[model samples]
Target: MEPLGRGDPRARRPRGAHGFVRSRDGLYRPEELYDATPYSTSSDARAYQWSSEDRSPDALLTRALHDESIDQALGRWCDPRKLVGVMGGHAAERGSQEYADATRLGRTLGATHTVATGGGPGAMEAANLGASLAEADDAAVDEALGVLAEVPSFRPSVDAWVDAAWRARALCPTPSPNLGVPTWFYGHEPPNVFATSIAKYFRNAQREAILLMICDAGIVFLPGAGGTVQEIFQDACENYYATGDKVAPMVLVGRRYWTETLPAWQLLTALARGRAMEDHVHLVDTVDEAAALLNRPPVSRPSAPDAR
Candidate 1:
């Protein structure tokens, strides 16, 4: 379970090579997380295990450096403000109606904007899958869904799950580019393969904030559990005090789910009262409605200073 570092005898690249520092690193492709094949145990899995077992200085340093690299890589990806984020529970099974809705939501949003997700299985994977095939026809999307339905969960075998997704991807005419931000903090849930570029981190807090911050285009939250609830408010908190043109639309799909089942909307609306975000928050029943709200004419704002 040893990580490749300064003391590793098999090392070829120096410490300044990609992934060791901010300057040298680049965004990760799904294949970069694997040792050899997509079916094999990922470097992320191995690193998580090593992190849990080792509390040494070097181990801590490795994690820190990796996170820094991810931050740098993210800068090269795209304008964060243009990214539309999809958040939901990881428990939604492949064949379930909820999974289908998330996928459709991603597809709709991906048609106009770059889609970003938490990069785990279930609804997150579903959304990323849809975004990747945004340019393809509806039949292709349905076929991919059918292929994924074979393996509902990744619990018993991640290999089988990944194999199915790879097969599904082969059906796409032109896979669109998308972003995935997964953290090793929740190591049990592996990152999905659908996202073209990944910025994986070791810190969950950093990952969460960055995900919310980058989605200035807005976030569409689907039915989810504790993590999803936290994200709703976290984004709300940012919007609450934000000035003109800083408020990003917050669309929560599943009216009953947000109003009755989880009841986050009640408090969310209360929080947005008398604020600039009041007009920006919405609760809708369908993914199409959510997409419509997000796809509305962009909010007029002052020009930001050039980056670079």
Candidate 2:
């Protein structure tokens, strides 16, 4: 046979002169890395050895679910405003007080924002779920819940994770839109189902960068782990340089977390004191304060003729 063309069926096969040939075992493939066929009862004991190996059902299901989620997220991210990310720890449990706080934040933002998250449990789920619950209209809430109920908290089994999410949605309907920008690298924590949509990624770094870039107003950083810290610095760098189309506000929530936990508050304060970035940063303790800072009108620059 001639060399495989790019558009040819054989092109999909492994390249080079290693032509397809049957092995001694009667398998019709050179790369017989694994036995992947069924053995009949009439076959000899040796025949069973070459029989196909079955992959773990759970693993197969998880992969399929993950692929589907990634595809869904990709579709959602096409519209930037459809996403609003919330970065926080996956360790936050379902019923914890911290989870409740995160949920409250989600609700407040969800009322006006699209409400996006890292798509795992804890704070992510709390925020999405809160937004899902804040819907005043029953029918609209039920529709949203039905859609999100497909995937619940991240778990060992994709089936369970998806089922739980669907259950949660069924239990609490939502009229507003929410999203989860989860990562397959952290696949153990499935995307929260409460999110109306998802924008999952293979790389956390790329996912985070995209999340920060898309937020028109800016992100709100709650207490979190290394991931949250990384985001804080990244956001600061963007603001300091005025990297994007406009210099959006970088509002840091939780004074204690910024001041004590990470000391970012101190760093931002020092940077602001330098005059170059005096009005760029606003460190606050409450959501209301952060919202107000974001909504404040921009100061107009003096015209050159007027200045002279």
Candidate 3:
């Protein structure tokens, strides 16, 4: 073993009789310099070098934090007039009806508005892919799919995800820029390649929270699991409290899921009937219906009386 560094008390040891003999080739004799000051210094240098070379953990964390910041910045760029977000499960499989439906929804929204997502595969990829392909020429669509073909699914390498997205850009391009707010915590689920821009984050909670906060236009909820449930409640809380930018509409895509399966629609309806939350909730069974609800103007309320 060797002294850790210059600040270490053991580093002050005296040199040996041969003044710590060194080879002409610049290597020191191990035994002669074991307890020597130069040896300690060398140990410290090696330690420093090792630390510098081992940046995997720090690099991953740094990227995660950067993703959070990027998401916030992208949220700022979204035009509330035309920005629409879809919330659903990441587990949606490629080529499934749910995925295809979600993609069609994205394509419809992309024609006239910007579509946003959590930036992973399944629904996210479908939407982005739909939008990208819907707007591009056939040749462009082919190129775009080629780029995305590298990582067509979520459970794969990050490089594949990134490369696919880059290639897609060369093929089916966006008429209007869109955003992807993904997180490094779920690094396995790479951001969708179809998004014109990305807002990646390290912290899942912060990413989810911020996403709900900035979706001022509205949110369309699809069938999903834990993460989706979390988002639904977070949005409900915001609406319940009349938080920032006022409460936007909450659109549920599938009637069965919203009304029967999870039954969030019933819960929201009950809440809305109460004095504290009246008129703040709406439920729709289809995408067209959801779109109509989203486009409806905000309701007006009587102003509070002023104190004399």
Best by TM-score: 1
Candidate achieving higher lDDT, 1 or 2: 1
lDDT of 3 by residue, 108-139 (tens): 67666677788777787777666656566656
- Worst ten in a row by lDDT for model 3: 20-29
* Candidate 1 C-alpha error for residue 101, in Å: 1.1
lDDT (CA) for every model shown? Answer: 0.83, 0.56, 0.59
TM-score against native, each model: 0.89, 0.62, 0.66
The stretch of ten residues in a row with the least summed lDDT in candidate 2 is: 22-31
Once fitted onto the true fold, the runs of candidate 2 whose alpha carbons sit more than 4 angstroms away are 1-84, 137-164, 172-174, 243-245, 272-280, 291-308
Q: How close to the true structure is residue 186 of candidate 3, measured as C-alpha lDDT?
A: 70
Off by over 4 Å in 3: 1-68, 79-82, 133-152, 156-170, 243-245, 275-280, 300-308
**Per-residue lDDT over 1-308 for candidate 1, one digit per residue giving the tens place of the 0 to 100 score:** 22455765536443322233322257778866755454445676776676667676666776777677678779767654379999999999999998998899889889999999999998899999989988989999999999999999997888888888778888984689988998888988888989888888888999999989888789999999999999999999888878758888999999999999999999999987767787889999999999999999855444333222
Q: In candidate 3, which residue pairs clash?
A: 64-202, 67-200, 68-201
lDDT string for model 2 (60-171, tens) is 3433443444444454554656334566788775555676677767776776667767767778787877676765554544444444434433444445555555555666
Runs in model 1 lying further than 4 Å from the true structure = 1-24, 37-40, 298-308
Ranking by TM-score: 1, 3, 2
- The per-residue C-alpha lDDT of model 3 at residue 147 equals 52
